[model samples]
Target: MLVTFDYFLKNLDLSNKNCLDVITQGQWLNVHPAALVFAAALAQKVGKENVIIDNTAGKSGLYIDRMGLYDWSKTESPYHYSRHEEAGRFVPVKQILTSNDQSKFITDLIPLLHLPPEKSQVIYYIMGELIRNVLEHSMSKDGAFVAAQYRPKSNVLSFGVCDTGVGLKKSLSYYHFPKDDVEALKLALMPGISGTSMSQSGTGDNAGAGLYIVKNLSKMTRNYFVIYSGTAMYKLLKYDKRIERPKIHSDPLDDRHSLVDKLPDFHGTLVGVDIALDDTSDFNALMEDIKVSYSKALRERKERRYKKVKFI
Candidate 1:
């Protein structure tokens, strides 16, 4: 199930100390989901919350040859186009990361969003997994997406991930099931569903584990998590395990009706996760980490280059 950015954030109770602190002030960021789980565990440990405002568009077909690398974002739109609107602010950063260095590119940006030890770790995993998939399978070196990190004065967090890829259409066009936006999305979200028919080797995914794990985590952690692929968007609401009885399956989310909506018959994918941090002050520290990490990495490279220069 996927959700929009605002709907995801609206469910949080931002008054808690931990939730308030994470979004307090002077913090902004953009990140992916693997890291999100890490963030959630800590937020859970600290009893904080977060939010997300996703606005990622379709796939970027990055092809490299004699012409060097092409920026997929610079190309024309798909043969058929579909655009959906969601909410929130836009923070300035690279809207696209498609290179041998994209994983590091994501690593460089992860710290900018203020997340505690656990949230940070979860996001690290989410971002790593997504970027790894993109690099290995998306067949494109460059794709585009945008997100804004909002740390409320309370220190809560909200971020989004947007991308234009093969989406569900291309992912499952060869299958025997429906192929339009709605059906495609519905099928894709199903656990263990993979667009590809012929399979071989490696990771145990293709069964909706990635999406399901994150969604379940969202409920368990009381954070906002949404996914929009083509026209089907599933939003897992922020649940209060403390107040609300524990839920084990997808049948009881507040937004379950959304799952039944006719798929959007669109293309591409956008995912967003948001949580409330207890302190906003750490937001600054988080950004500092991004800068320091990048600077230190750059310095290391410069040193390496300098040594080679001397040897040469």
Candidate 2:
């Protein structure tokens, strides 16, 4: 059995399907961070008893147990779990954020991820921005689901936020409409693209900078960043050298900066970031550089548009 969005959608008969068995001993399963969120959502909907995990050896098993995906009711006190210096360990799954208490959530997560003050601040900003996006835009009545894992040996931290609402294509169609899923994914990463008209002319509560800032941070840190929604997946992989103005595509076709198409057609959006821990780099400086670069680009674009206008 393969555990993927396609697998779940194809198998509508939850009664006959043993979801846990597939999770524990499946022949193949996508180990993407968001995949766990999808699994947890599935378990909750299909009844946890229908899914039974007899094994907990690999990353898949570890994630399933850590997130309380099998039986959320059995989750231990404090509702947050962490294993220090261990790869694949994460803060407990945050199933819903009914209130505006993101600060507390980030404060609690910092120590568990073992991030220094500087890096912690960056992560805090990223999390806060993304969570705000979910609350304001996802349109999912179920709210957002979030999880993060740190791999000490690899010096990588991965986190993802998911929702089961209208996908990016539909969301952004309200402004700067995209032709398809791939185009929607690309537009979302642009500095000024947003679902809200209030974001127009950079005068609203949102400047459409969340994903833009996140992508730049990923590039500067030489990390991995990806957004999967509808039938497309856009990604940026960490490399030794710096990359400026990474490409966005309808189909990147196995490139390092990939834009893949024809995915399982997720109803909502999943944004994941994998940051490489580097104590030597100055986090504040990197952020400043991103801001300056973005400002320059925006100004240049405005000048070009101004020049093109026929001011009769």
Candidate 3:
């Protein structure tokens, strides 16, 4: 189960001076995009030569190879498949270090999924915001590492973006002090709150709405959006499908979600999202809804500030 895997991830010891041993058990392996991107980010952090895939262990070894983990690490995959045969299925692991590279990835991503413009719009929005965040704020020389898979049977797309750089608490510390990792995540998700600025509204260059928009998009679509950095992780759980109209909260904690602190520390940030294509709405319409929610959240936040203010 993914929850068990999450617990297992907490036990990973990332301090080895020589090598990283990715040990797996059982006959089958269900590798999540989050795990794949994290491993790739770690490989870059520790140097590819110092990494080892101890035992891929089953038929699923081929799946991992196809997803391009082996290509990112020192391991040479034993299984092989024709590149021409993989069209519109998945994107191999890709590293982006610049704005140009980020733009190019977004351009090349749509055709790989073979999704219509309407269906692929959210993906473009998500990737653009995520990669831009890494390039602008992560302070990672290696930039962002991304990978995704389109599951045809379930009509779902899963993707992960990772960066090995200053984590949330440290990044936000430039302008706002978050006492811990989880609190940093909370501020990161709050609309108009930015690490780059202390104002109620962010600076001209950044509105700080990227993460907030992405999280609400996932909720409005009834899917999951997860953020992990340092020793904390915040997951926006799936909304109840029975609810005809789900509320989008500016405060991430108000939504149906899960959070964990005190996990093994990851130096950078990791984000994983699952999108159900069947539930996706028109891109423009969705953005409009988010705009309304964002404005309201900011207004309410300002109102609260005055309520607590002491008149001289």
Candidate 4:
């Protein structure tokens, strides 16, 4: 059976079944990233040995080989380089990272990817913040899973982070209640929505700026930024040209930007980013732009609140 969202939901209750068959012999199983995350989490929950691939001699085998799916030797790294080899280019790898081992993982990845110092810093910041989010908010005992691939010819870098934990809706519900998954995702991306409650002194994730900053950076680089949690999915496509700030569209029908609802629900959250290696965006300037935009948004929200109060 193909490992799709439906398959995941169906197999979630792994009770009497000893081995959950993911793929048949010689059949190519197309697995979505979110499905991969779900499978990994399930495997950890049940015995990894209990998840079986019926046929291991075809495309499915090669896929497993490329991803190091079943390899669990402590001496072997969870990261797997792509089987397709290109001369003088880095082999894209899917790596599993834990909060405890992130530093070493980043250190090993930096040199292999051959990223410029500035670009490396950007990746570091993005990955660090996302991993931190998983550690702090995900509540997943198994930690986070990440995958990255860079096509040198196209100069496109694609990476994703996934965690099977309390999804965005549940996490944000601890702060402000959301009517649905879509609203919860929107609120999570806002500048000051966080599960972390304020202290007596009123200092906390006052900026709640992690996702906000990541979104701005993606826009500045004219890259793709996608987030999926629960049944909602949000995507920001790369713009044709640079803009001071990109508009966020909440309508799912918007082709340029997508905010979709009613997707098959995943157990946790997944964030995917795609950037061009030749992107010339200045990191500091992008950060400043985010701050300005956020400040403007805060002012507008306060003004609306004040106007409502006056009308009442």
Candidate 5:
């Protein structure tokens, strides 16, 4: 289990350091987009450069100790049932990428999925377009990406992406029509509107097609997308039960309340997404951990295995 706010309290100063980033599934689910903007901005203001973050060992600050500490001999990943002796429901998953490569990797994320090649590739392209907004725009120095899949006897896999970078408010303002975190979110869903006029950093999506495509795909595929920034938040769900009706605050306002007016007091951006997968015979097995272009995380993992440590 995750430690109490004690981690937050003890690392209050480190929050600016980007030293502690942890949250429950519910917490991540309920994260206010404004917080995403704030955290990314604040992390930047405090000079939180990308420190070596590793999730393979569940070493990322957000993982529970139980989800973390592991015996070396138990080498098989718990994600595989054959290796399931005793473990928690979570593990650390990490990635480090340069801005440009991260953008490319976004496009690459799709083929790794079990979905049909066409769906996965197009999804990667769409995701790539959305991520282009982040890597090209969010403006934070460091970032992190995590993905996990669970088979509750259902035909689906869940995944998410998070980062500490320039948030939607700043990026939105970059285009033109600015709004607070909440309003910007609504604006994102609207077509033919964007924060930018012709800026390259943003997806430059005035037609609102990029976001709309994501929203539409989420509905068609029965996937879910939760977007947050600058305290403005929105969620689109496509389950069999009931499709979510668009909120009344649909037409997003201008950048009057965007999060960038005060640079030093803000945190970076964070995006969480989930797509569905058909239930196969073994939906529980994960073929791989996140595969980013960066190799440093892998090199570090190999190095750690050789470091002989003596238990007291």
Candidate 6:
């Protein structure tokens, strides 16, 4: 029988160790940006001196090298190629440790993709939120590892961001008590739910809508967005394009998604998103829609809370 994505996720192990050992299947192998960043984040945790790759036996291995994963590990690249030639093709594995580095990386990223202002806006919105979450919340000293790849054939842009720090359950422990990683993920994706503060309207700086907005944006564009942390993974399945306007759900479980638990425990967080450029909507208009939706969701949630009161 064929296995689901959850099956693989359940099998993925990233335990704390003094060294990192990477082994990939031979023959055909497809590597997603999420996996790449996850591996990079693990390597950063163990130090490059303790990282090793057991095999580099096929075109897949060469692609890994091209993605600059070798630089993160102690393994030497078996193939030699000009680094300049790889430019503009993809954002290789990059480590961003501070806000300044994040800003500079975003600025330099646009030209390489050669995207027009409108298209680049989506990238900026997605990336800005993804990186900022790691910087402010993850509490990982190593920070975030991010990467991107644009496939010309499909016209889809893929992004991955990962951090080796306290996962969602721990992050939400301050104000919310989630039974497990999956429950924490649900709260994390809800608008106005932030670990930084107990207020629904997050501290002046954070509205707690980063992940919610990004996932909703992916749904609006009929794309895929995945968030994995603490042995649980929640995937926003691609929306049906046939629907003229898909209803936005305040509760993530109401949307088309897959939630699986009991996976190998990962100490941090990992996110993977794919955006179809052709389906991307106007950035400003989309943001406005998200704002309205967020407000409605928050209002409804509050109403539900009020209804639970005993008004005798």
Model 6, residue 20: distance off in Å is: 1.7
Candidate 5: list runs displaced more than 4 Å.
Answer: 1-119, 143-152, 198-208, 238-266, 278-312
Candidate 2 residue runs with Cα over 4 Å from true position: 1-32, 42-59, 72-89, 198-200, 241-256, 307-312
Please say which candidate is ahead in lDDT: 3 or 4.
Answer: 3
For model 1, how does the per-residue alpha-carbon lDDT over 34-78 read when each residue is reduced to its tens digit? Answer: 123222322333332232212122221110111111111123322
Q: Write the per-residue lDDT of candidate 6 for residues 16-105, one digit (tens) a residue.
A: 578887777675444677878888999989999999876645888887888888888898878877667546758888999999999998
Pairs of colliding residues, candidate 6:
none
Higher-TM-score candidate among 3 and 5?
A: 3
Pick the lDDT winner: 6
TM-score of 1: 0.50
Give candidate 6's whole-model lDDT. 0.84
Which scores greater on lDDT, model 1 or model 2? 2
Residue by residue across 29-91, what tens digits does model 2's lDDT show?
455555666655545544556555455346556555555554542232232356444323576
Q: Candidate 1, residue 306: CA error in Å? A: 64
- My TM-score estimates for the predictions, one after another, are 0.50, 0.77, 0.94, 0.74, 0.51, 0.94
- Global fold similarity of model 3 (TM-score): 0.94
All-Cα superposition RMSD per candidate? 20.4, 5.8, 2.1, 5.7, 18.0, 2.4
lDDT of 6 at 5: 43
lDDT (C-alpha) at residue 188 in model 2: 78
lDDT at 77, model 4 = 30
Q: In model 3, what lDDT does residue 114 have?
A: 83
Write the residue-wise lDDT of candidate 5 on 162-203 in tens digits: 556666667666565555765566656554345555421235
